[model samples]
Target: MKKYTADENRYENMQYRRCGKSGIMLPLISLGLWHNFGDKDNFDNARTILRTAFDNGITHFDLANNYGPPYGSAEKNFEKIFKEDFKHYRDELLISTKAGWDMWPGPYGNFGSRKYLIASLDQSLQRMGLDYVDIFYHHRPDPDTPLEETMGALDQIVRDGKALYIGISQYSAKETSKAAEILREQKTPFLIHQPRYNMMDRWVEEGLLNTLEHEGIGSIVFSPLEQGILTNKYLNGIPEDSRAATEGSYLSESQITTEVVEQVQKLNDIAQSRGQSLAQMAVAWLLKDQRVTSVLVGVSKVSQLEDNIGALENLEFSQNELEEIDRILKKD
Candidate 1:
């Protein structure tokens, strides 16, 4: 395997923000392997994307146990790239994986039970070729399992050195507050919260952000582009090679209605006025709020990563621009 040497000035332009009240600092833009880092994906393209992201100062890489089509293939593939390129720089990276979703067939393989969380992390660490992950998340709330049991598993993982910090994803404000209290009682480092937040999806602002702020939990928002809807790819109708047309993709063609295209076109005008792409403006809008620790972005190509990262160059928004956006999005 050829060794990879990262850019010596990789940190030059990358802005790092404190994760809530924690000592850790994450890049304004983090890479998520939720889309193309799988067995069915091209390994070389995936490797390039990872390399470009890291070179551009994206130190945090997010993954989940059930991310791939076959479940866990993303971790397995990432392990190969990590060992070949990043093993020597482990301390410089923050890798996270979740396990709350369904991962296997047996009753013990899914949910937030102590057995499932523990076993899942063990398997995750093995697949990633790491003794510990920077963060471990309960992918989603499991109403079937006791919150105590699920949180207890996270506390145990930190204590056993299997994970450095604990986080929760797709959790409601009420559920987040409850989980934070439990983790606090255990004295675990409940570092961050991963929520699906974007220009189109403003659910996080509906009290989830307040909850995280109250608990001193940092937030890394996923889908800042709203599954490509906030980008130019959908402006001229979904392309045959686009995610909306791809089978099994979370973004379906039916979801891209004519109204959505019109909205996107109007939003693109705002982006062009700001001298940025629609995607760049979308990511920049999220960063305007200090509560957002980082905006998680997924890209299939290195060019996409570079284009998205350009949002950092100009994050400022005039008062009129903000109001105009609201007017467009809220105009039914």
Candidate 2:
């Protein structure tokens, strides 16, 4: 409850990348409020995490309407933390939030309809107590709704001054090209794409990264740690209190087979050789590619956040290391 002042040398050690061809520059590591910023979590810890992120020059904070367990709690909690610590530094920060997933119960509460997208941003803005978010994203592709309607709503949001720029998440390469075309026709600033990319999951490599590069749209990847599987936490086995141990979590025990543990152990050995934690190595591996504008990282503790930030120390990989990583991942 004391005052907060950001570090004077915050930007000295952190790295920034231009988001696609945009005028905005995002930190190499951005903080995500997907899990630990909810109402059920510790408020003081969450506040400390936010402060730690900002103090370390992490200017971009990503959130979604349905991020919290009860939905909308993350934004509400962020509002309190922002009002206390970050209100004065708003200009120095780039805050983003998304819609397009299941937010509310009714027909208008979900999907890509203009009504849903527009209303969702209003609620998100209200929850976060902000006049406008730096960037707003459609959380996913709504299979039932037309893509034009969804992209059109995003265009409208920018026109209405509700959001500065628009983005999309989890869209395929073809779909991304189409959406980019629609936004381009309208001259809307479709700035970034939020995809799930990591050492474990390479779906974006199929065509999505190339598509983003061709279309001149940036990407900030989520789940770069593969729901914590890419880290050393699972090298031995799933801990009793780990996400894999919890029922109904996104990562389950079944996903962590003996083979997966072997792979993680091999990865951990490689990480130790590089003088980095497994989590740090996993994150640095993603940044090795220039197309990755930023890597979205989520953490429960401030130390974890700092560890992720430490990935900036070594973002390079030799051909041998790259080949070894490919061999490890491609092994049956």
Candidate 3:
């Protein structure tokens, strides 16, 4: 193990909240290695962001087996850092990784089959330079694979001490209920469910929120800023360095139409009334539901992270403000 030291004192401003009924307490804001921190990007900059996140109370760093431009590069980069400045601070961190998406070229490289699931986690563990990850997630649902096989693999992971908990991402309410029932029967803790939720996207409000609340499972919504569309960066037009002009598979030109811009402007008016930017207000909005344990945020630079971290300064949203926002964005 490499020698390192973390400022155990910063735990003061850093708030850790319980994940629903589970005893696991995660930091209010978690950093995600979804776009940056890959071999295709600058390693030094990634290191800076990771350290900055740690310095600013972000203890959880989320990654997956296939988060990079060329799959597995994100985990490989994280493993390199874990072997360097992060080995000794391992106990102080909540590093989570996932599988179940398309990884390698072969059939065994993807999905939730026991063969694929277990093997993918093995690769993740090896790439992260750890015997186990605190949270292991199934990236998406598998329609063909039996839920029992997936649950069994998760059970084996905990039984063998390879993962402390198992989570599901982008799962529908039906699948979530089914998985929760089986896991509860086997005395397994379904820790968290990650979903793409934001002011622009209110799909989860239909039923997913009630499902998680009823089942007592935790939720950490991603894309809460809608890939930075809520920010003032696009008020005029797409800047050259924005995610739109970059290699973004999620945020593209087709998404930024006159209608989206108008809705964003109307929402911005509401955010300004609250004395917050649209991005900050959006982040604050997600935390309005106490059921949401954390908001997984992605950034391209330290300044972006700093601005995002400032969202904690103001989290309150009044009923009228929410109603006005709903009028404009609920249908968008």
Q: How well is each residue in 1-332 modelled by candidate 3, as lDDT tens digits?
A: 22445557657776777898898888778999998878889888888788778888888999989998678899999888878888877888998899888988888888898888788889888877799999899999999999988888887887788899989999998899999998988887689999999888877888988999999999988998898899998887788888887774678977888888888898888888878888888898998888889999998789888777788888888889888888887662
Cα lDDT computed for each candidate against the true fold: 0.93, 0.94, 0.86
Pairs that collide in candidate 1 are none
Model 2: per-residue Cα lDDT at residue 245: 99
> For candidate 1, what is the TM-score?
0.98
Clashing pairs in 3: none
User: If scored against the real structure, what TM-score would every candidate get?
Assistant: 0.98, 0.99, 0.95
| Local accuracy of candidate 2 as per-residue lDDT tens digits, 64-109 | 9998877999999999999999999999999999998889898999
Residue pairs in collision within model 2: none
Clashes of 2: 0
Q: How many steric overlaps are in each model, in order? A: 0, 0, 0
**What C-alpha RMSD separates each model from the true structure?**
1.0, 0.8, 2.0
Q: Which ten residues in a row have the lowest lDDT in candidate 3?
A: 1-10
Name the 10 consecutive residues with the lowest summed lDDT in model 1: 1-10
- For lDDT, candidate 2 versus 3, the one ahead is 2
What is candidate 2's local distance difference test score? 0.94
